[model samples]
Target chain A: AQSVTQPDIHITVSEGASLELRCNYSYGATPYLFWYVQSPGQGLQLLLKYFSGDTLVQGIKGFEAEFKRSQSSFNLRKPSVHWSDAAEYFCALGYQKVTFGIGTKLQVIP
Target chain B: DTAVSQTPKYLVTQMGNDKSIKCEQNLGHDTMYWYKQDSKKFLKIMFSYNNKELIINETVPNRFSPKSPDKAHLNLHINSLELGDSAVYFCASSPPGAGGTEAFFGQGTRLTVV
Candidate 1:
């Protein structure tokens, strides 16, 4: 079975601070990975995805994720997070139907 | 323009009643999908359609049937809805060939099966 795990249920960070979210998955070989962000009362927006080569994949809204083959992990990183960046982030793995994690809720404090 | 959209942002209904949720995408994508987000906020795939053809059907109950009149529309009809069916349903679309491209998602329909 293919599943994605987001270690943190929620995380709080001050505005203009660095942020990193951990995500691990169980798959056979290089599976397609994706990161999605969802705001309150809104639809999901794509953050980034990793298909093949180039472990470092950049996405919109100053978001980026790196695919680690050995660790079976695809963690999202942001040098500095803004208040608008506070939302639920989901890490997924698959092609046919995405298997999303429980999601990590991020809160930005002033 | 909206790429993907679903009807009735919120649905409140009684159990044992049958209902249907309509979904349409204007992105000109060949593949469409239905996902159920539980109370825990875990989104899971329920069914998928490509070019109006049923391709991927997850472990969903037979009561939950997806009807695709065309490639752009996929409606989910539930027969005798149960309380456990109360959750957020989202519609998404992809280009084709087994989800190689990014899928565009709709705003989601919050179905409350009482």
Candidate 2:
């Protein structure tokens, strides 16, 4: 079965520190991958996506993800973490009906 | 203007009661979907409609039925709701494509079954 996994359930980072969230996917073919962020009591927002070309894709809010075919991973990264970046991040895969991961909660400290 | 919108931002109802959640998208997308987010914050796709046609239906209970009156609107009706049904429901829409178009989400409706 095709599935997306975010190994880290919860991560804490200090403000202004670099952040990286790991994501691994299992699919038969080259699948469409995405990253979504959900703040507390709010709807989800698309962060970035990968489809065909250019393994590295840049998205809104200074977020970027690289699709590594060999590793079967599409990990999200940010140069410097912001206090407002603390939220729930979900890695998803699909075209019509997307399947989301269990999500990783990020806690930013001062 | 909101691209995708869902009515009843918060719903608190008693178990065994039937309720409906309505959704509409103005982005002129052909595909729309409904997803359920559990208390643990896990999201699962429930149903999907493409141009007013039922396309994808997950292994959800029969008590849950989705109606798409038109291409722009899709409504979900739950019969005899149970306590386990309490969770946040989100409505989303995306354009037709083979390259995986991005989805626009609504400000989910939080349903609490008491």
Candidate 3:
């Protein structure tokens, strides 16, 4: 049984401000982690994924995440958020189970 | 070409009617999946087919039947649709081998039951 937890339901940040979204997971086997972004009425787009190797991974739209094995955390970060960056973000864990977090709704203020 | 596509981008029908949503992947992938996104925007996997073999099937009602004519197409048929069934359904495709392989998603079909 695999599960993902995203503590924040909604997060608001100003344009050009840094942002970090927290995600935690519970999985027995080696976890396959992913971060996805969903815009209004659009399909989810992959931001980044962590399979193995370097814990720090970079993704599209200036997003990055670090996989912490001890803490079971894979947090997504962006140095500076753009207005268009506001959307729903989901964190997923495992390959077989593939449980997704409740999702964090990001709001970027101009 | 679209990697994954679903027909009837919008479906509106009355309760108790039967409707079907078709999905196809031109990506030549070996795996296809059906997911539902409810009004709360929570995405849940309903079924997964790998190479036309049913690999995963959630606790969906028998009214929801999925048929994979081949590896490239997986269609979902629903019977006795109810208002609670209104949601956006997405179809995704991916190749077999590893799990982390990115699953390409279709534009999604929004089903509304009146």
Which model scores highest in TM-score?
A: 2
- Compare the candidates by lDDT and give the number of the best one: 2
lDDT of 2 at A74: 94
Question: What DockQ results do all the predictions give, each relative to the true complex?
Answer: 0.71, 0.90, 0.56
Separate clash counts for every candidate: 0, 0, 0
Q: Write the per-residue lDDT of candidate 1 for residues A50-102, one digit (tens) a residue.
A: 89889999999999998988899999999999999999999988887789999
Give model 1's docking category.
medium
Residue pairs whose backbone atoms clash in candidate 3: none
Candidate number with the higher lDDT (1 or 3):
1
Ranking by DockQ: 2, 1, 3
lDDT of 2 by residue, B1-114 (tens): 888999999999999999999999999999999999999999999999999999999999999999999989989999999999999999999998868888889999999999
Report model 3's chain A TM-score. Answer: 0.97
Question: Lowest lDDT 10-mer window, candidate 3 chain B?
Answer: B94-103
Chain B TM-score in each of the candidates: 0.96, 0.98, 0.97
How far is each candidate from the true structure, as Cα RMSD in Å? 1.1, 0.7, 1.0
Q: For model 3 chain A, give the 10-residue run with minimal summed lDDT.
A: A92-101
TM-score of 3: 0.97
lDDT of 3 by residue, A2-97 (tens): 889999999999999999999999988788999999988888888999999999999999999999999999999999999999999999876743
Candidate 3 lDDT over B1-114, as tens digits, reads 888989999999999999999999998999899999998778888999999999999999999999999999999999999999999999988777655777778989999999
Report the lDDT of model 1 for residue A28: 82
